[model samples]
Target: MVRTAAAVWCSASAVVLAFAAIHLNPTRSEPAAASANGNHAAVKTLQHRASQPHDADQQLNDVYRSHTCGAVAKANAESAVGQPGSIPCIGDQVKVAGWLEFKRLVGDNVFLSIRDIHGSVQVVFRQEDFVGFTEVRALIDKLPKQSVVSISGIVTARPQTAVTEASAVEIAASSLVVLNRATLVPFDHQQTNVSEELRQQHRYYDLRNPKLQHSLQVRSKVTQVIRSVLADEGFLEVETPTLFKRTPEGAREFLVPTRTPGQFFALPQSPQQYKQMLMVAGVDKYFQFARCYRDEDLRADRQPEFTQLDMEMSFIRPIDIQNVIEKIVARAWLEVHGMKLELPFRRMPYQEAMEQYGIDKPDTRFGMKLQNLQACKELLSQASVARGFRVQVPESLRSPFKKALPRLIKELALRNAVTKPFNGLPAALEDATLAQLDLVGADFVCIATGDHAESVLQRLGKLRLAVAAELERLGHPLRNPNEFHFLWVEDFPLFTESDTAQAADGTMALEATHHPFTAPHPNDAHLVFTDPRKVRGLHYDIVVNGWELGGGSIRIHDSDMQERLIREVLGADITKFSHLLKALRTGAPPHGGIALGFDRMMAILLSARSLREVIAFPKAFSGRDLTCEAPSAISDKDLADYGLKLIAQPDTKL
Candidate 1:
């Protein structure tokens, strides 16, 4: 049942204990050779003397001996694990039963420790105390680790025992029952070098690891907090389609073959189209913990399926959209981190962020802000004159980035910092900055110049990150994980030349930078038709610590504007969007919303190295479910029924 990228909802207890991940390794466990079905029996020898030691608190430990055991001690163990409320239930007889985890024994006295999901309590056994049950006495000595045992005992106060995280009281058991027995533990999961492959294969055992349990608990809590805040703010939770039509030009899709031959349903890339229609249908506010799927090659930040906090609001302006999202974000911070994020997070234009940090999602924790070489006539002359490369500028300046990217990438490879699949950024970068920017080393200063401003900034952005990594190793704390630098990058261009699009004569054509529905900035209205490059849209992306956490835009509500932009500017066909086009014609209200990468945020909150750490059963970067060996070939009969042909046979070799 290990489905790749399956959505898991969180619970309240999980949320509270999510961050409580520190492991309480048992002070004592059975020796490795000790097994339930054992033949070669070896036990650590214990000192036979069991007299009143000078340590009075240690002398009173019920686990060591039954100093007090009687019929009076037989109530619920949970109420006695810790003192009930403010009052001590020290003398209360408790009937607590849970799996036995740890034990210690002296020659004449034995100790048994048990724990339930709720709490842990100690049980004491002495040979003299169990007079009537010789068989039970032998069983107690033979019981394996993780044996399910229930014991009735009197809770005795131990004022002399060392006060630690565990309860200050012990239970002197008058009765015991071994409900079930467990075999020897499978492997040493605590090993630092334990492979992820092993963990995924033995995932059930992996979850038993306290650290992973805590992470999952935290994930549960974060989502619950977000859901609560959204509900209080009047956002209606709604369900959207998982199986829908293909958005062929968007992120790659996972197609589900249908009953009809050659027909298939695509898993949604986002709840984008449906959520917009909801706005048109007068659902003023809509949200979902949406399950989204995309079939692109995988990375640490991506899964073939993932969760997004899908939201849309009607009759809202650009700031209105930003305000609500900021509120949710701030509330999450306050609840989890106990700090108020600076009200109305700091905003920068797309151009400003790109120029300053070399990336739209800038990690502002460190100061390696890119300095424009051209800012100084001397620096510009020095940069271009020494170790220079050339870019062939194109006449159209359309998709010019494609032409400019190669040489700069080659330069990065020269430095041994760049490689294919390069953008899989770490979940957290602690204090990594462009220390190299300040270093006076005997090497060429990296400079990017190109026809398209975006192309130049994009290349520089990659180099900025590369340098940041190098700086961290060089001892610079530029991208500090401890810092929360939430940024709003705004005024993104409304259109860019689509890589997949072509003009009538086979030239690249323009498409919405974000989406066709995004509204052009009111100030850029004049430039929409005149110069697409300068026409900034009311689109924004929210980032933290260099990760693009969420993105949204003020959607185009005006029918005439939508039509003109689609037909005259972008040259996209209008007939296919008839439903949305009709809704706009019928007077759609201005709407906008943002979708937060929920899983990515969890990774950040939990300090995980990858999204898979937060996800329950995430597929590997190869897009295969390692636990179940999925992405396996479909049955030949089913393929034939679906009228599909094999392009190439799947390799049947190891």
Candidate 2:
């Protein structure tokens, strides 16, 4: 009689046994039937089994088993495992399985590179080892690149020089079994014929490339760092509904038809309203790695769907929130790139920034300041008079110059032609006059290097000759990219006058430059009625290298101000925001938050040309995922299952 049981082991030689033996005590009862037959039969069987002592051990050896590897598992194992231990020595005989990433045929011996969950190892096989098996060589040749294979061999430390020179160490090989074959071409050998469309269609393959893999890894690290930092700061990671009620903010939403007829849900453009509502619910610190969707034009920095680290905190001033974020961003930079940013970054008023830089988000890295020419009218007037009596004046220029003088003077608001003393003109008038003349004579005085001083001045002699020949072709001088001008625009107007659309009540309305919820500055609230353009909100944006990294504003938590902001300023229907109004009435706390473009941050950090390079599966310029073939038409069955219907597209006569 043989007792059979199962055993497990990491390697073939190490047998593991189960502890299932039962203990018998004097107090325990025994079955009457067992008592009659067990004593005589057990005694005889025990005596018989003693004659064959190796039976139990042989059965245990047979029970131990190994697993076969697959392609994806092999890839996962390679990444999961660490480098082999130092000091070459043979370990226990083990059976390992994974994909053979590489192999080299050396005369009659083959060097095989195999990776398993434990790690990768190099295996050597001699021709004589498989002397009776011709099929082994044929199978080896037929093995697909990246195909899964199992090898049972004695583990041994690699030779000293071999370990140092080789990409991988450790050699083992006894038996090999192919598990799964990879169908696609190896990533390195993929053809040039591969199209962007095909790459997107087969995104799994596209992501296999080392460059994309590393980029996605970095992106993951960035998000992890953000989550860790925010969590440490007492931020609650709350998830908001992706399907939301449609409310017009700015960008259009992708509507989802509902099972209930005539009703629909809109995909969230952002978790803006919900996060604010969280503040109302007494969840003071809330943050989410939000997925935002929008139906709008796409650019390098813009995506149909993108991610942002959205955060909001209650009972805090605008500056408090800004400081928290500044610390987080600085820490992120230091942790990720080992660079410490200057504390308390400079803040600029919106109005002043616009006036000087002609746009917000001034790149403070370089300088070519836009000089106000109106302040220097005295210089312009003097130069004009001196030019008129210059020794060399072309006859053709004299008449046209005189004709243009009146137009320039009128545009500059000159009091008189010659009688208006330059010094007596107002500062604004002087600056305007100088800026106008400078526009007409916009040639740079290029002093050629190594030229004689007299000869360099001679180059100026050709100015009139060149201007006469190509006056129509040369208009204004080109902007120089080398000169970087940095500035902070402050005091941005809260509203802008526009005529794009009528208000909800069929009346003219003022557009909130930021948003309806942004709070007006305490001192500027009264100016909203008297002069809307002069009123500024408690809003701020951080711009660097001419890119808007993030923006936020103090929110209107007071019910009265919130209602007035929507009704009077934005001209939005009061009923449309009833839920928000209700929340505001429930003792909402003062709060503000900012959402930074993660992709754009990476772009600036890496100095990449486009944000797409930092994204793993970025949509094309037209907002189509070429790799996944997304935005493809859905099957009628799927639509029916979801209780949806497709709207007919308008016909075009192209």
Candidate 3:
């Protein structure tokens, strides 16, 4: 009857069957619960492989390591011999397994260096202690570098004069077993001159390098810290859908077609709408390490697909969101850099950041604030000097600054550079310019003419960064690289003028500076309908050094406000975002969220030159996955399954 009952349970769901079987059969359950008991004799033998010395010295064995290479080194360093409550040290037998890194022959002794994922250690084989030393030495000589082997040995203290970084102690080998052998590798692990193409092709080997290993380890530690901090703050980790409908949020998206004719699903550029919906679902605090996609041109800081530290909250102002993000960032820095970051970072309005530094994301670590010279035209007779800035470059940087001046002037659509002391300028114009700016003997000024006030400031901002870069290259950095300057840049203009686009009345069209979801500032709310360009969005960006760490805004939860901004103000297609509007109408709360660029964050932490260094598998500049050679051709039959056909070849130039 019991057997029949168990068989019946097995016919149901496997999970249900397993539960039932465990309850019904004590014989089966006991062994599964514990490693060893009266029912299992093999446990004793399995335990013997870890610490006990083998009876025969020359005999090969299949059993592997009892401790890691790192662990072995740590054990010996704790005490001279062996200490109570610590791992085995001198004169104790142990087993270890790893790939061979190198081999050396000295008289009648053979020395081998082995390394695993954790660390490396040295193994020594002596003729006096081994019965078949000559044969083993010959075999070791024939083995290739990076061959996998397991060796049982007795631990011994390394000679004081002979010890190096590989290990502080040496292992006296009892016996060895060959597990596998590797072929000759393409390039040395640390070879800097290796071509990137070849290294990418053999990325598995490339990842074995110590620098990459350390980078991955740090990445894991930082991610763990973020998870712990968010979890402690009462945030629930959630996974949102990636296959979503196409909507005009920002960048281009990757489209996935279905068998249903003309029906398609687009990969989400972000988890924006879903996270907002999570707020409506009563998940008050939510977060995810989301994988996002963007079908756009790539750069050093960007990839076709990347990870984002996405999060959202309900019943929060812009400051509330900023505070939470600052906590997360501080915790992450503490874990990596072992320093406490100051709380309540400095805040600067977008207008001030642009006016003083010439860029929205300003690196406040250095000084060289831009000065608006609009007052100069009032002192001069020239009427066309509509907008200008008095740029003062240091005398020490005059040569490099001069070299970068011509290119900067051409890019900004500005006029010539003016050296101090009024070389060829008329006395009146020179006096007007000098009077507007406080200039020392080492400072020179450049005044842009006819450009808009905003354009002039932005161009000067570029010049600010350029000067900083040149200063650093010339062995006189403006500020220390290690110093982190955290700032909150907020109160940005809601809209920007489009270059080639026009509105319905043929006037200049406007685009959202951040996104359409951002609510206008309380003081500027009325301006949205009248003069939208003058309205300020309640958006905030967290910047560090010169990089925009992340951004978020207090979103407009009211359906009416959202629709007006998207349809009437920005002139976007209403139908594409109707679903979001419907969700908003279903009694959503006042909510806000942020998505931090995880790749860029990692690159910043590691001080890596490219985002590809931090990513496990990143696309090349040409958007090609060199490892697998992806984005390959699909067969016609496979295309038919999706109810689609290739229209033309992919553009090689793209």
Candidate 4:
């Protein structure tokens, strides 16, 4: 069983001959086959000599693997490699490459699991067959997990009682070449509970996790489906500049300094203006997988830089844009998830959504719909509307009120409330209200009241989400995670009270609800000059399972309205948007568009808790790139080149 170097060469020669006959030429005369085999073997010998590591360096760059682990597994399944008296159709001599995921030595057999992007396979190296089994096993043991290796072996049926976690068919390895040895990883890639900081810091290792791998794969598939659907809809894929001018929509923008003093190029928050300009340029329909940046506080769904599925169209109404978007979404869902979405998604006006669900992006999967307590004559006299929602306390909690009440109060910011047994209901509540809400077993009532019904409902909306979360924690979930609820929330007010700007009279200003470019609703157009607050915009938001997937609006092609909204209502500098205003004046067609948050969409589709799970290299919660450690400090000389200087150091360490 102890083979020498000469014996190893002979065995290698035999493998080369077998590979040539099985793969190079399956049908040949005996003499021709023998001659061809000899030539191939000689070539293989020369390759081996050329690939030999010089001195102590173990790197080999010439090993060409012919098969993937996925292909090997497929071959096994299709050819019935594990069935009795069955032979696989794949050639016996196979060369495959991947990272070493696992390894074990049992008796004379060495079992090693190799994983590539497509899949993983098990390779069994035996002392009887491998000349330097001891040496190879020692090297494999010394190498770190995830070390890159190329294995040359014969594909064979796994033993009936092998009891392995590998593919049905396994490889009997003749030789193993260490392509690249990895260092000790910070944490095991198989671990599920690794800290987010560590994961983000070591994203390369994080990507090795199967969950992330699958998420990335699904992301790619979703993108492909979207592209295909958009292309089929006659939409041209366009690319807009990421380096854009400073035109504030709402969010803070990341500024890139120029060599000129006090001059900067701001990263685009979206491709809104560019796409509109494209519409003016006579590009009837356009779409982009646009890269957008926002200098804003981080959240589970927000990233500093993200991809947006931006689209625009000319000479179209709101319904036309909605129909096209619906088609793309329906096709994407059907192709990627094999789920047929109901045609023409349900639409809810902004007023109706706020009145009923307390939020524009309502999760229709569950019914904790807010109640109008002001419906009662008694409560109506006190406030504009008494917004309340009831949640059933699970029986699992022995002290339900003691555990849930404190959290609910803090979350909802509820200052006024009454806690009593179901039998001791408040006198203000009507019997019909109780019956309609189905509050028989419910032990908790969260209510918010104010003179402004909108204000009250906004607070109660937070309570609704908080209550649902509390119920889930208490072992009773009102919402189904598996459900898909698509809704179009429309009829938003054209202008809202601005939080930042002020009027010339020192009073609060009005701002565009969606954007200044959004046109007023046709019926409400006359109110724009009379009562702008009452005028509604021709805007529509696509909501799914409590998330605002995307939104769009019919844009104003007339420069007068655009300029008025920017200069008068919004109190914004008209000079900043002169380009857009000029484009609008140049016979621009009435257009509309939508931009879907690609990261948020993927996260919801894959059931990921945070956008980070779907993103390849996401920043930490503080908008810091943990992988590259970005938002780094600039050297004084580099800053001088940009004609900038740091006036003061940060209050906290980065």
Q: What is the lDDT of residue 265 in candidate 3?
A: 96
**What C-alpha lDDT values do all the predictions have?**
0.64, 0.57, 0.73, 0.75
Q: List the candidate 1 regions with Cα displacement exceeding 4 Å.
A: 1-88, 93-162, 166-186, 375-453, 474-476, 499-502, 505-507, 563-576
Full candidate order by lDDT, most accurate first: 4, 3, 1, 2
- Candidate 3 lDDT at 460 equals 71
lDDT value for model 3: 0.73
What is the C-alpha lDDT profile of model 3 across 1-654, one tens digit per residue? 011011111112111111111222321111122112212111010121224345223124324577666556554644544332235677666667787878999999899877776777788877665434565577678777777777656678888998777556888765555556676587877567998778777777778776787888988988898999899989999998989998887789999989998998999998988899889889999999999999999988889999999999999888888888999889888888887999999999999998788789999988777755556565533544333334345577666666766665566454444323233333555654555564333254544444466776776777777767765776666877688899999999989888889998899899988878888999999999898988998899889888988888888999999998899989999999888899999999999988899888888888888988888778888888888987777889999998878899766543
Point out where model 4 deviates above 4 Å. 1-63, 77-91, 162-166, 375-381, 393-402, 415-423, 428-443, 505-507, 650-652
Q: Is candidate 2 or 3 superior in lDDT?
A: 3
What's the TM-score of every candidate structure?
0.73, 0.64, 0.83, 0.87
lDDT of 2 by residue, 1-654 (tens): 111111111223221111110121111111011122222211001112224446445434531214222221132212332223222324434455666667777677677777543345677765543332234444466666666665654455555667543333354454454445566753542456776556655666666554555567667777788888888889999999999888867788889887676788898888888999999998999988888899999887898888877888888877787877777777767766787777677778764554334356755443233333323424444321122111122455444443443344344332333422122323453445545534323322111111222222222223222323232233322223332222223456787665677657575567877667788888998876666667888877766667787777778899988887787767778886788899999899898887777787777666666777677788887787876556677778888867776788533321
In terms of lDDT, which candidate is stronger, 3 or 4? 4
TM-score of 4: 0.87
Which RMSD does model 4 reach against the true structure? 6.1
Residue 29 of model 1 has an lDDT of 15
Index of the highest-lDDT prediction: 4
**Number of residue pairs clashing in candidate 4, backbone atoms closer than 3 angstroms, sequence gap of 3 or more or interchain:** 0
Over 4 Å off, model 2: 1-138, 148-177, 186-194, 355-357, 375-491, 502-509, 605-610, 613-617, 634-654
Sort the candidates on TM-score, descending order. 4, 3, 1, 2
Full-model lDDT, candidate 2? 0.57
